[model samples]
Target: MIFSALSPLLRSSALQNLTQQALLRMDAETAHGATISALKLGLAPQQTHTDPPELRIALCGLDLANPVGMAAGFDKNAEVPRPLAQMGFGMVEIGTVTPRPQAGNPRPRSFRIVEAGGVINRMGFNNEGHDAAYARLKGLRVPAALGVNIGANKDSEDFVADYVLGVKRFADLADYLTVNVSSPNTPGLRNLQADEALRRLLNEVLAARAKARVRVPVFLKIAPDLDETALDAIARVVLATDLDGLIVSNTTITRDTVAGMENANQTGGLSGKPLFNLSTQKLAQTRLRVGDLPIIGVGGIHSPQSAVAKFEAGANAIQLYSALVFGGLDLLDRIKRGLAAAVRAQGKTNVSELSGTQVADWAAGKAEL
Candidate 1:
């Protein structure tokens, strides 16, 4: 009611000025921390039954109250999972943590392209070590599904050993685990996305998972920057290894879409609005290649419409990070409502029913619009 009454005024230049002022005063780190804190206090305990059921998704034997999740990088140290899970995320994936702690890239690493409603971050894998992240996860009380994102330290000569070590130490604590071989920020990290490297890494990690008697699902996070050949190769590798699901993408190195923005030149993986189409397209291709395997679609999801688009593109679940930075906690509820409505409108019973439903059209380039 208040929003309706102020609708006209809200569209005015005054409101835009005020909004910019608010954003200008907050950096990404502060914004992310504050938003997680609010979610912890405001939405964590809310009943899921109060929201639409169509928003829920099941992944790796865990029932997520909603398909919406917090992607890797936000809680690099695993400090905010409980708060984030409580805040209303279906799941929270923490870290990109390496075997040992290392300072990420130099400052000015995170840049907000307010004009484009996007962000670019090259904060390497700056994280406290696995032990630190594991300690924090050990104390989390939230009921939401939780996953840990593991990565190789930037300077490690034995990168594969770093990943194996991560699985040995943190896999036991995670409901699931993600091998982050896709982050473009860390030097030589993206190379791990190559078929041979990924195959070797997954083999070792799976062995470690078996050794720990940890039957938890292991998913690989890939880069959206891949071409058809690379993606196809990745699919083959996943199939050969019999690994679990794939997080369709991490972030992209492409800036063709947001080149007009002031900070578009910033180095890092680009995310948010600029990434939506590319990521979804890649997701569609992945779904086609992988057949029935689950894919977590992420990147540029700021609204329920985008979330549904990902669902239509073949994502079993969806994740968000850049959106919260731009839209605030209210965005979660809005996405939930919008996704529920979209699902019902399509006459779908649950989100799972809609996965890969539009792949043919998406692949033909006819459905994206």
Candidate 2:
């Protein structure tokens, strides 16, 4: 009840910081599970769903209360969507789910690099599979928009079939669906981002979406480590495919940017503060290639400044995961409130007004991904 009176930021600071301190005392994966469990038990404080006009925006046609979202991997099993939504995200994306259940890599798969304000995760596409998530999602309700991020089972035989199955199974449940071929932990997953493979994949995904009962929007989440040629190739497929939007640049395999930090050499995708620059640049680059297509920016967003940078770099909206690990769920409220402040400071009424305004600048000098 202590939190039932305060605004999101104040409430979060009053509660989440203490929770985070306790969670931080545990291992990263354990902390994540505990957090999820707490949310499921309704222990997290509820946040008002109201959004300032400046933060209100429609993404791929779904009316979001604000632009900030809970990215996939936070609630991989679709366990606590409403609790997360209550924690203040305008959108909550669950799972990199597959047609069947998977245990992911192994224990110790998630590491927090406090010095770098980053996380190195090789958890693979671990989840309870499509059926479980589908069941929970079907019974789930939330004020925020929900998206299901789907992936191929690590040992899946028919990759395309898995995606098609995911779409057909959950399209009716999700506000939108994300085809994730970007996670570095799944072996050969990123390879699917290549030109020919990407074309074939997106075609199937698009076709699947077309046939789904809901025909919800479909977005492609790509990796940040792509080269120019790979990016150009993926862009062609994005342009050709009737995809709904793109989640620009998943976590990175490269440590060059966060070089010399402990766990910097960890063999997993790195995300958090260091990812902001690369992912934003990649978002700008994608926007340049696929003009007018909506994009959900992810990677390294830990503050209002980074969130504003994401919108300027061309994101229709943005998602955050690793930042939440360090900043807690209330970080979503902080970023949204901060973004609204930034928008008002610029004399803007809606967040969309700033989307892609600085694409030319970031894309111009951005080093090839």
lDDT string for model 1 (1-369, tens) is 000111111223433333434545766555455444433444333434554677667787887888888888877888768766755778889888898998988876888887877888888888889889888778667668888999998889989999899889877788889999888887888888888888888899899998886688999999888988998999999998868899988888989988877889988888887788888888998998998888899988878888888888999999887876667556777888888888788888887887888887765567653
Where model 2 places Cα greater than 4 Å from the true spot, the runs are: 1-19, 366-369
Root mean square deviation (Cα) for candidate 2:
4.0
What is the lDDT of every predicted structure here?
0.78, 0.81
Residue-pair clashes per candidate: 2, 1
Q: lDDT by residue for model 2 over 122-198, one digit each (tens)?
A: 99888899889988888667789999999999898777778889888998899999999999998888888888888
TM-score per model over all chains: 0.90, 0.93
RMSD after CA superposition, every candidate: 5.2, 4.0
